[model samples]
Target: MTERKPRKDAVRNREAVLAAADVLFTRCESPADVTMADIATAAGVGKGTLFRAFGDRTGLIRALYAARLEPVREAIEEGPPPLGPATPPLERVPALLDAVLCFKLDNRHLALALEGNGSDSPYRAEHYERWHTLLHDMLERIPGLTDSAFTAHALLAAVRADLVEHLAGHEGLPREEMRGHLASFAAALLGTRPRGG
Candidate 1:
């Protein structure tokens, strides 16, 4: 038996909706400002179609966030060193956290929406699990890193969207400065930093 493919119109509609949502989310001051109705109007699709395609606002946000993260995920999964599988645990651990921090920083609005939209705990999100597992696995490979599970959670917590937003938006921290701080923190945990000058 052959697998079923989405109809051409469904594919077109999905692309249109995603494109419209990307623009709306990027342009709006807050993700809350971009509603399903607004997205439907922007995409020239009926509200029912939007609901059918994405289930609801939370689902749509998850889909959009996943789409935005595809490149980063691909890099970690298949690209070159510091993030790829071939990199040493000491190097890759910090690089993975850096990638996550940069992703949250770059997609602040989307990340904020997906994490703060009141659907459920951000801990329960699929992406969170993926990051946690990847970090945990990397930390396990590092010598002297005994609590890989807890350490993974701790490191990821530092880059959580809410915390990143607090530092970036509320505290007015610079992006590079925040990245540096996170890198230093991760280095300390992994015992990968060189001795003082």
Candidate 2:
């Protein structure tokens, strides 16, 4: 079925609301403290319009997070992946590492969490679950693993908050060096390496 076109004013109103929310999220320290009226006033829209545009604060957060995740999604689909029928599983390791770094850089909240060593929460655990699922699906050929899911979880643990802080902060290693070394270490364990960094 053909999609009906939305009216111009309706589109403008939604854009205004999202723009306002973006500003608030970037400027505010704690997202939980921000209110609907705060968003409405910032956007120059009515409180009712803010509520109508984004049902509630939770809906707003979900939309905000999803918007941030979009580029990461596109990067995964088109920027890097296994890449070829001939590209070995180990070759994908660096791509995976790079992807995770990109995601962390893109999300300010996530970056803050990383800085604060806040990777142990239930919220972060959910991200690990999704990351592990994706890794298991992509690195299916890694040997010594009857269970790829279990291995993925282990790998994520290796790169978790404190570990990452040690690697990038305390250890004084360059981010690219850490990525290459970690990918190589994993690839060595996997027994197959991808050709490119």
Model 2 segments more than 4 A misplaced: 1-4, 80-87, 110-130, 156-197
Model 1 agreement with the true structure over 149-196: per-residue lDDT tens digits = 999999989998899989999999999889889988987888778223
Error of 2 at 170 (Å): 12
Which of the numbered candidates is closest to the native, going by highest TM-score? 1
Per-candidate clash tally: 0, 3
Candidate 2 backbone collisions, by pair? 90-194, 91-193, 91-194
For each candidate in the order shown, give its overall lDDT on alpha carbons.
Answer: 0.89, 0.62
User: Each candidate: RMSD to true structure?
Assistant: 1.7, 5.1
Model 2: per-residue lDDT, tens digit, 2-103?
999978986788778777877776676654456788878887888887677677765565566567667665665566445333444555645665566545
For model 2, the local distance difference test gives 0.62
Give model 2's TM-score versus the native structure: 0.63
Q: What's model 2's lDDT at 3?
A: 100
Candidate 1 global TM-score = 0.95
